[model samples]
Target: MTSKKSDLEAAIDAAARILDSATTIGTLGHIGPDGDAIGSSWGVALSAHKAGKTAVASFGEPFVIPRHFEFLNQEVVVPAKEFPEGLDVVVSCDSASAERLGSLAGAATSAKKIVVIDHHVTNTGFGDVAVVAADASSTAELAYRVLQRLGWPIDADVATCLWTGVVSDTGRFQYSNTSPETLRVAAELLEYGVASDVVGQELYERAPFGYFGVVSAVLGRAELDADLQLVSTALFQEDLDSADITYEETDGLIDLVRLADESDVALLMKSLEPGSVMASLRSRGTIDVAAIAREFGGGGHHNASGFSFDGVPEDALAAVKAELAKQRR
Candidate 1:
């Protein structure tokens, strides 16, 4: 009397059951949350509200919300300092691993259940219930499906959040991950009156003047490797200080490096703090940066990924170059 559930349906059903059973749920994104992370976390929390469940959206780290994503409803996202206590369940979105949960790792582990909904190839299926959809364009897209499968309302506000996630992760549908299904989902979201131009302007056109200064300084430090196939640059804390910019401003600079005509791999290394280095990798689709990032204890999509190093920028760059060389060979 019943038909087999599709894989997507099964996963959504599992996630929905977990969500429905919880009286109070906490939705968390990874540390240094990005557009997809913020979008997915908020989308899930909002959907929970529509389903008559109490939910909160939050991140473990305290960050100045990126100016581009300021359009997100601030009221729905709980500040790190204000994270509530005694949540019955915690749902992590867009994060691949438990350790990457930052300050919320402890709470997630201590909670009654930890549900992981993500679209990362590197995810190892952690948590009490894992709904990982690597083929999906973004976690936000999967979050939408979870809401839809559960028959939850996706109002215009929720549509905007999911749209931002899909757009950001797909590079406005320029990335290779954009599929017919992705476009279809996007088109449906547009029906909810999602303001595409406003999102585009905020994400791509509203860069502060200080961003250009930082990009210039970092490019000046760029170095091509022996094969000239790898282009790398470094941004120290002093560089951010001198330019009066924050770490978030360097978001798109790697795109400039990845587009280099002569390079196959683009690497951006930043000194987030003393003895701590963060490296973001982007490729022209010839390489799987996610695999390389994993070698350095990081994970992400195939074409883009990042990892943090426990040493100086030079040391991190050297390790990255060595791993890249090995991978290429």
Candidate 2:
């Protein structure tokens, strides 16, 4: 077995043992709590709760929590702002690099015993224990597998959380990482009484009125590479302010670009402060968008990724165009 896989297996084992003995546990995901973040946090929390341990799933900013995750509405699962004292273990879920962890990163660093579970490409062994799978699609999927191996068992609520993470991370099974195992996990979660239809509708079938409006405008103006495999669009602050768009509004825009028939890559440009531009990059196949994102001081998964800009959206678009052209061969 590879060292990375071995390390993950060992961490899962240790986590199970911790659950067996720990009294108080704190759990959290990265700042922009996506589906993986929500699912991993809730799945781990629910698992610990099932083991009769006191587990509170902590999240970052309010907007980071997606609307679809309203199903995870629990009184005990709250924000990471007011630190709970005397917790024996603090587990960071679905967060790989500390840089993406926001203010909660300090909490994890200062915890009595910190555990990190994630599926991002940038994990650098940043915890007392690190369980990372860069190719796992979603951290929630890994977390569920861990709990299962620990004999903690997966429940209905846990299944719902797990499914949400998987579904979101895979872009409703549209991403290249979707595999037989992913479908298998989805089937298993269904057996646990997770309403797949509810989760699906919540995730895929709904978008704000402003969301479609912005997408319509972007699509109308999107540029295409010669092969039509690369699509590019620009978004101004005026557009954002007019639609009351938040960072979350850009969540799936990159996905749309990748789906364009002509392009292997998609780029979305946004203006920073006033004169700066931030860019997001998404690609299919073996191209590593994360590396491209790193060039712009942002990082994420290989196929689905993002980056911030140093100038206006137009300038950011120009840089992204150069990068995409450079990758064509």
Candidate 3:
């Protein structure tokens, strides 16, 4: 009797075959690509190049690479407009849904084959070959395994990209998602000459002068609802404008807000534009923040999740608080 392959294993096998036969490939990450998204997409693209395939990697509109990830090689990355049309294969990295692909969804949909590599629990499985592993620490880990399975060479630069993804998504291995396997994969990548110190310094240690001002402003108004075990804060456009900061620079602010020992949950709401808000949610261990995000047409892991709102920050906060109230009752 033959044993059935796991969903992830079967998906990887199918993706390898598709990639092996393809002459041209396009890779994309989600909009406002995070370290995991950027690293996974580029890692696969670099690996594809090593295998002697023509590959392009890109993300959706507002295609700015965040300041922290500027060290990554952009050899294969191109603007969405520059991404070749009618590619033989399209691979999406770390995007939970087709909608998250933003302007590039059409490219994936039109491709002869689509491969989805991700670790998000809420992934919609939107590809011909879906390697979705909710248990994996980061999509980069899954990407590493897929490349290894395909017998692709992971050079030092490739390892650096993958290392960034693992470190970022795992919160420097402090998040609950970190497992022995996660550390093992990271160790292997380090063996490939990944500059761990550079990654750590760029990602966590260094920030622009303006960043301190923005942090001060956001922290000043932080609220703690001890009864609900919730700590929350809101950042308006003025906060960024006054500090000469961009919305992207506020990514690490939630980590500070979530440090309140009295609260098990933390929420950060930021103004994207007038009447538009984006939120980041974090939980220490008690709450399933991802379920809350899903209620608002968003999704993520159990501890960290987010959503966008069409209303003012106050209304968004009210809605999230209401949901938390319901959960407690």
Provide backbone clash counts, one per model.
Answer: 0, 13, 0
Alpha carbon lDDT of each predicted model: 0.84, 0.74, 0.89
Off by over 4 Å in 1: 1-5, 226-228
TM-score of each predicted structure versus truth: 0.95, 0.88, 0.97
Instruction: Record all residue pairs in model 3 with backbone atoms less than 3 Å apart, i.e. clashing.
Output: none
What local lDDT score does residue 193 receive in model 3, on the 0 to 100 scale? 94
Ranking of all predicted structures according to lDDT, beginning with the best and ending with the worst: 3, 1, 2
| Cα lDDT tens digits for candidate 2, 1-329 | 11477776787887677666778888888776778888888888887888788888876654255565676646457766765745787888877667666776776666678777888786666777677777787887788887888777578888888888998899888787788888888888889999888887877677777887778767778887665366888776666677776656556766676677667788887663676666777777756788777777777788777776766666776676666656666
Of 2 and 3, the candidate ahead on lDDT is: 3
**Highest TM-score model number:** 3
Encode model 3's per-residue lDDT on 18-135: one tens digit a residue. 9889989999999988899999999899889888999999998888888998898788999987877688999999999999989888887888889899999899877888888888
What is the alpha-carbon lDDT for the whole of candidate 1?
Answer: 0.84
Quote the positional error of residue 41 for candidate 1 in Å. 0.4
lDDT of 1 at 200: 88
